[model samples]
Target: MEQERLVLEVDVRVAQPRAPRRGGVELDPIDRDLEYTGSLLTLLDPLGLLGGVTVVALSLTHGAFFLALKTTGTIREDARRLGTTLGAVTAVLAVVTLGWLGLLTGSAWSWATTVVAAVALLAAVAANARGREGWAFTGTAVTAAATVATYFLALFPDVMPTTLDGGRSLTIANASSSPMTLQIMTWAAAVFTPIVLLYTGYTYYAFRRRIGTQHIPEPVAVG
Candidate 1:
């Protein structure tokens, strides 16, 4: 199941590798280059940081999420206790990421992007406080999506830029693969992704109910 989902995700990304441009409104070299530089040092990296941080965030997010779902009414081994610990850690990461984002982008920030990120952080915290499982997970998803979208949108053409020599920076216009390749991947994704999604959804529905200690039979003693 995880493998199928990953395959679908790879297809999705392959179909659309180049991120959003800065609405095609070119910034002067000073502004354009500085924005990228500031953002980079502030912990947003194209080839590395965002993806790496996102994977960590997603793992922490999943830890909290499943803990919320499967732990309700499960007192034998209080999953919420572990879930709370995970939430605390994820919250710390989220706060740090949010702070990193604000340090650079807040002043030069787009209100839409910044606001969503802020709201996401707050939502996660609040949902956890109230034990709202769905909302807590939703907040994590929003936080990841909004942060990624904001960074990519701001990044625009440049795929990766360096302070040493801005001349060599990679950009979407130059870095993208062939259009035909993307189209082929798009068709492939369209064929397989829905099936994977359906199966995943069905499994979740099948296991929708909460579990308790009684669900686990006692262990037999060994001879």
Candidate 2:
């Protein structure tokens, strides 16, 4: 809702005189940027609104954790279960994404990015099947990053094109913030982003080792 409102507010395409013909961006004309953003927003809107599904699922999964310790073990078994589940989902999504890529290719978007995304997803599936958790994680990350990279590649010169007038579409040069603001943002990101990344990477590396159910300690009540 915030983004939709922002798009409606900041889009001064009406005043710009060159905006595309004012009909909604039709998938047929295949405006890659609009198609990508519209579809992504469609996916995200529900994900955001329906995020409580994760919390509910998490609550349910806690039972498995307890049962694991008392029965056949949980965390390690969950890891393998997750691997199988994610592998199946990834494979299915890969096939669907490949079909989506074919549509994107027909629409004249960058096919190279699709290839990268597919390869990364394939690597993830392979690694998951082989029980290489770290590699699988990296592959999944690469697939996600590649997809975002492709979105930008598809967005080329236009930042946001008004369906009312393609000519009025915002270009990178025109859409950029003032020089001073850009410089401040650049500096801020440079200073803080590396520190945050280092901290996060250290945490992941520290927890890289394996643990069996036997290693799990008993919970104690707090006074």
Q: Which model scores highest in TM-score?
A: 1
Model 1 lDDT tens row, 151-195: 665556555543333334567865687999889999999999999
Q: CA lDDT of each candidate?
A: 0.59, 0.53
lDDT of 2: 0.53
lDDT of 2 by residue, 192-214 (tens): 99999999999868865556667
- What local lDDT does model 2 show for residue 104? 38
* Candidate 1, pairs of clashing residues: none
Which stretch of 10 consecutive residues in model 2 shows the poorest summed lDDT? 19-28
Each model's Cα RMSD: 14.6, 10.2
What candidate 2 gets wrong by more than 4 Å, as runs, is: 1-74, 94-109, 221-223
lDDT of 1 at 98: 49
